[model samples]
Target: MSEYHLDIFMHIPKTGGMTLNEIFKKQYKLSEIYDHDSFQKKMMNMDELTEVEKRNIKAITGHYFYGIHQEFSRPFNYFTMLRDPVDRVISSYYFLRDYPGYEMVKDMTLEEFVVKGPEAPNLQTLMVCGSQEIPDIEIAKENLKTFSVVGVTELFNETLFCLKKEYAWGDIHYTRKNITKNRLAKDEVPSDLINLIKKYNALDIELYDLAKQLLNDKLQSLTEDEQNQLKKFNLEQSL
Candidate 1:
């Protein structure tokens, strides 16, 4: 019944993706969803899925790169949310410190983490470009065009409105998840550390700015009545 055979959610870390994942759980039956931790925990890679399993899957959500489309035989759509690089890096550092299996970062300073932490710089770009090495912004931008919707963490409500329209999803309401309460606010971080984050995430900063423009354009494309509906949605969420 859906337009695409499969819908892929590229869950970039520290980008408010967990909230979206929760909303996704409500939209699809557990059997229809292919989550990395749930349905495919034993598999080494997505390529291990049998043709029958792939065909039956309605949605796939995970911290995966953009190229997963190569593994599918049917038409698919990709959607993801990105965050400001500086804020994302800061959040990731603190969140990983407390997260199991990431004990390596427990004693690392923010500055050390920014310079050498895993998936630290231009992570959004890397995910989009599907490269572990230095990411290509142009390639990332080109790949972004194939996505059905691109959302930004800073414009979360607007992103939700777009997602609902794009997928005809029901009951988009959700509570936040995986929040890093111990992280320092961006303003509270020292100037040198802020600059250090920027220095390493320059490409991400550019990519995020472009994503914001794309999201804004999508918001502006809504009809007057639809715009009013989005406004009402925002108002309701605020309260």
Candidate 2:
């Protein structure tokens, strides 16, 4: 039997995924690490960590696209977190531009940045993980097919509720997000890019709706504004 019920946490950047990773590491005896920066290592990360550390590992997350491959020799569960595509794209813009590497783009205005998008300097990582490549929606669904659960960013507590039913994880700690003062980046994503993201990530949208329907009762408990927030998308195109 496996020590952990593995969940992938298909990370949609700036969508509280790291917060999830932090909770997994600090709260659960099992530590889930997100290998965002150095994905080249794969299992070498596990090999290098202390056995005690490895034993505490419950999951590995981040925008690990392509395939699901882990060194752990046991059956495991899979899960990922997703946000509405529009917000997701906007966050990607800021995360890349504000954070490291994207310093090259700091000088460009949002209008300039949107046109330059994906190709914006040092934004390859954000492009690959964000809507630029694999749609955030598709990444979440494809991840869901591989894992037992799909955690909605809009309804994360319930996602954890389901997971904890099996793991008996105690009091999941997390800060609820709302009305933060941070300005949005890539604020007005052009229609062309919006349609492009839809084409690439059709499945992600489907999965998110499916997840919402699956957790309707739990989601209904949210505020009206919070409930509508799920529909926010980077594009006006009909999905």
Candidate 3:
């Protein structure tokens, strides 16, 4: 791993990142953390910043590609969450349909959105792969391996547990946010659409599976007490 002056949260869209953002905010000082909006705005002016100014930023969270790391002068740790591709695409479709800026998908049917949206396919893989064009799968896998934390949205609690152990972060508590509205239940979505999602996001499905296995492996390594602690945290969040 590279020596890092800060941690970068490469937030994948509609992957429970909104909730994680809240959790991360509590773990770092206000002066040390930049939320997504602020981070992007700051990046535009980064070239003018001195080394000390850049080093002062302890953490940055945003929806951005891997190459953002190149903009920084010092090394930084990366973290991100991956989601089940089918579910993620479904969520993204609905989320963008209503979002003010995404007029392109505003009136699109789910099918149309999946087929036509510029960022609808293999987005998770694209983000990590660090390219606008077709991404290299091996590079994406290697990039994820270098992350200080690579989490899965489906296994969010376990991911939190992994982060707690890996970084000794404070209070892993989180409440869900940015849930897609009127989402069809997995069983409710038609098989044809599901297949289409799979076809469009094949790489994301592979990446998601990799993340799941990695998370499961990390969970397996936890001591009984650590597992119990995570359980306790889950139980607390439920109430």
Candidate 1: global Cα-lDDT?
0.88
Candidate 3 residue runs with Cα over 4 Å from true position:
1-4, 37-45, 48-50
Tell me each candidate's TM-score: 0.95, 0.60, 0.91
Separately for all candidates shown, the number of backbone clashes (residues 3 or more apart, or on different chains) is: 0, 7, 0
lDDT tens per residue, model 2, 117-210: 5533222222323444434544544444555555666666666655454455565556544322365544466676666555444554566576
Clashing pairs in 1: none
For 1-239, candidate 1 gives per-residue lDDT tens digits of 36456898999999999999888767887667788645644544666667787777788899998887777778889999999999999999999998889999999999999999977988999999998787999999988877889999999989999999999899887778988897899999999899999999998998898899889989989999999999999898888
Specify the poorest-scoring 10-residue window by lDDT in model 3.
37-46
Q: Order the candidate numbers by TM-score, best to worst.
A: 1, 3, 2
lDDT of 3 by residue, 1-239 (tens): 32266788899998999888888777776657667656424544445555765676678788888977787767788889999888888888878877888988877888987887856889999999998888677789999888877899988888887887887787777768878888776778999999998998888988888888777888888899998998898888789
Please estimate how well model 2 matches the true structure, expressed as its whole-model Cα lDDT. 0.52
The CA root-mean-square deviation of candidate 1, after full C-alpha superposition on the true structure, stands at 1.7
Which runs in model 2 stand beyond 4 Å of their true positions? 1-7, 29-56, 66-68, 107-143, 176-181, 185-203, 214-239
lDDT of each: 0.88, 0.52, 0.81
